[model samples]
Structure formats: structure tokens, C-alpha cells
Target: MHPLPQLESYAIRTFEIDCNQQLTIPALVRLMQETAMQQVLELNISVWDLEQYSLAWVLIRKRIEIERLPMLGEKISIHSYPTGADRVFTYRDFRVYDEAGQQIATAATTWLLMNLQTRQMSRIPAELLARFSGYFPPVEMALPYALDSLPPMEQAFTSRNYVVGWYDLDFLKHLNNVHFVKWMLEALPEETLAKQQIRRMDLLFLAEGNLHDRIDAQFQQIDEATYLHQLVRQEDKKVLATGRTIWV
Candidate 1:
């Protein structure tokens, strides 16, 4: 049973805050993702290492529940560990705590190792999975399920379209998951953002986007503060990602 790796003493910077003066959903998600990357690198397997075998890691699904968004200048600690792997899916857990040690947020994410050249799921090496040994944290809840198809809209409540550029790509040469959340948030009117704070989010990545790929982003309100979002390939209309966010 190996101890979970942790990124501690993170100071919430002013630049990381949203209009509401608290950590933004995209920023928080980025921190967790960075933590996961660090965990794997500590095991002596970097993204370039995976690339040598024509492999890359892709996030399949994520569910984040934030009890209280940390504010500017607060020092926090993030702990994460690979819970286990099943087939081609690897599950990981994350916990965030305030300076006083009070828990503030938790997340569970599923990732898949894939053949970059073929875009097919790849099996994780036994040695790679063995490093985790005995660090299996119980999931706070079931991981998010795949999003249902978005119902047809007379027109997108709010939509944005743009081409994928170099800045949008991660090491995998595809849209970074945090940017998906950022684009979704950007679709909302300024007034809506000023009045609400995102508290829960579930995202599922359906397809990958390549450099110069044109993306059509759409947002539709599900209720007062819940919205459904989708990103599609403009040329083929293939859905790239779908997500739902709940705000308070």
C-alpha cells in the first residue's frame, strides 16, 4: 500500500480567481489535472515516455464537487492517488483542503491510455499499475456517466465557434480538458457569471480535436442555474465533448 502523492501548500493566487473572487472551475480543474500529471511523472513515466510507444493519456470522464471555492491568497493542499485500473480505464481520486485542514473539494476522474497513432485505447503496463500498490481511495460518489445526446435546439442559447490553435493543444496534441470547461463558461452571458458560482461539473470527452480543427460550441440552459454544453467538429458535426454544470 503506497501512500498517495500530494501537492501541498498551493497558494490561491488573485489571477486564479473568477469574477466572483473565488477560484474558478477551470482553474481548480487545472490544478487537479496538474497534480495527476505530477503523480505519474514521479513514477518515472512522463508523457514523452508514453509518446515513445505512440501512447498518450486521455481523460475519459470527470466529476468534481466543490463544497466551498477557495478564495485569493489561501494556501491549500491537494492529495491524489490512482485508485485502480480496469481494462483500459484508470481511476484516480483527489482531495483538497484549506489551511486549517478542513476539506473543501473532492474529485474522481477516469483516464484511458490510448494509441496516439490509431486513437484506440491501450492497455496500461503491469509495471506502471503496480506502482500504486495499496492506495485505493473510496470514491465519494459514482463517477459521472456519459452525457446523453443534447436535444435539438431551435438555435443555441449561446454559441461560439473557433479553430483549434497551438495554444489549445495539450501534450496529446488535442484540446486540453480544462479549456473545454473554459469555453463552456465563456458561452454564458456576463450577467449570469456575475450572479452564480459553479459548484458541480461533469464532463465526458467523446472525440479528439486536432490542430486547425474548427469547433462549434453550443450552450443550452437546462434550468435556472444548470446548463448543458457540447463541442462539435464544424466540418463533420461529430461531437467532441459534452458537459453539464450546476451553479449556485
Candidate 2:
């Protein structure tokens, strides 16, 4: 296995950019996810490799800080690597840069290994940790803040309902993580989306949503530019995820 981190280059495509010509948050996350998958595949520790052991990776938390959003047609580079692992969680980080080599964004993510059949969290395997020995010295990026202690959602300032669709499910048969961000933001007012850009976002996934599940996305204003968000399954009233976003 290579000890070096992976670096991939890409051009921001038209579909990846929003109406304002800036790359959307979900699009950036998709790029990061793809880059990480490519790296693991090259190292022979990808999801397919793990599935042989009845293990699968699940993203539990992620935090992103945006310096600037890349415009459509802009060339950018993403550097990704496994940071480290604990008893129950593994870490990865990403650095995004523009063509000029200026850092535009950075993200840190935490993942858990789950037993495919049991649907329970598993401890990090020593052999799996050894595969990333060469990629030591985790990048100095800000970790997801307050993920374990999200702000209370006393009252929802705005809310929306969504019925999980077929396309929303990922390979695990659960709603993809990125859609949670989209749903959370959908609960915000149009004026908030139009006037402000998200400077930072923190998300903590607590449970999974399945196809046809009714989800209530709710947002509570925390301050002038900060908000607390939650996605709850309507039938059970179970909170699937909690998040906070700071807008500028």
C-alpha cells in the first residue's frame, strides 16, 4: 500500500455549479467522496474489499469550511488521506485548492465500520489500520465541531417534509448522507438561501432513513446567521440527524 496521500484534479462541471455559478455544497461533498473512494480502491481497502469480511463503511460525521466556492469550469485539485483511527471510528480529511494553488476549502470526516448483517458498529480492525501506516500525521484541519453536542431545536423557524425516494438510497439501502444536507437546507427560507452563503457546516448522522420514509426537516434559528437543523422520521419521531450551519 502506498503511504502517500492521493491527489486528484478535476474541472468544476456545469451541473455541479448552482444558479450563481458557484459550486454547491453537496457537489463538493460528492467530489470529496469520490476522491476518497479512488484512494481506498488503489490501496485495495475499498468498500468492495471490506464487504468480503461482512464490513461496510458508514460516514458518521463531517464538517466543512469553505474559503470560497469554485466557479463553473474552474480547475481544482483535491488531496485526501486517511488520518487515523480509534476504537470505534476512523478519520479522513480533504484539502481543496483552486488552479492557482490557493486553498479554497477543507473538510474532516469521521466514519464507522458496520457489520453488514448485524447492522451494528464494529471496532476498527488492526489490519485495516496498518494499511494506512504510510499516511500518518493527519492533516491540520478543523474537526467537526459540537457534533456530539448539537444545539437544542426548541422551535422550528421553518420546516419542510420529504418522502424518501428511490434515488435517495445509497449502496447501503439507506438514504445517502449528502441528501441530509440538502433536506436540512430546504427547510430554510428562500431569502436565507438567496442572501447568504454557507461558510461552515457540521453534520452528525445518528440514524438511517429508508425508501418511502416520511422525513420532517426542521430548522431553528440560533442567531443572526447560525441555525440548528434536524431530520426526523415522521412515523417514529426518531431524529435521524442533527446539524448546524453558519452562513455569511
Highest lDDT: which candidate? 2
How close is each model in CA RMSD to the real structure?
A: 2.7, 2.0
lDDT of candidate 1 over 1-248, digit per residue (tens): 53565675688998899866788888888888888878778765567767667877788888788889999888889887777677788877788999999989988778888887787999987776666645655544324333344344435654788788999999767888888888877887677788877777777888988899988878888788888888888899888887778888
lDDT of 2 by residue, 1-248 (tens): 34366799999999898888988898999899889989999877888889888998999888889998999999999998877777988888888999999999998888889998899999878888777756756344434433456777898654799999999998888999889988998788888887799998889999999999999999889888999999999999999998999999
What is the Cα-based lDDT of residue 93 in candidate 1?
Answer: 78
Candidate 1, residue 205: Cα displacement in angstroms equals: 0.4
Candidate 1 contains a number of clashing pairs equal to: 1
RMSD after Cα superposition, model 2: 2.0
Q: Weakest 10 consecutive residues, lDDT, candidate 2?
A: 138-147
Q: List pairs with backbone clashes in candidate 2.
A: none
Please name the candidate that would achieve the greatest TM-score relative to the true structure: 2
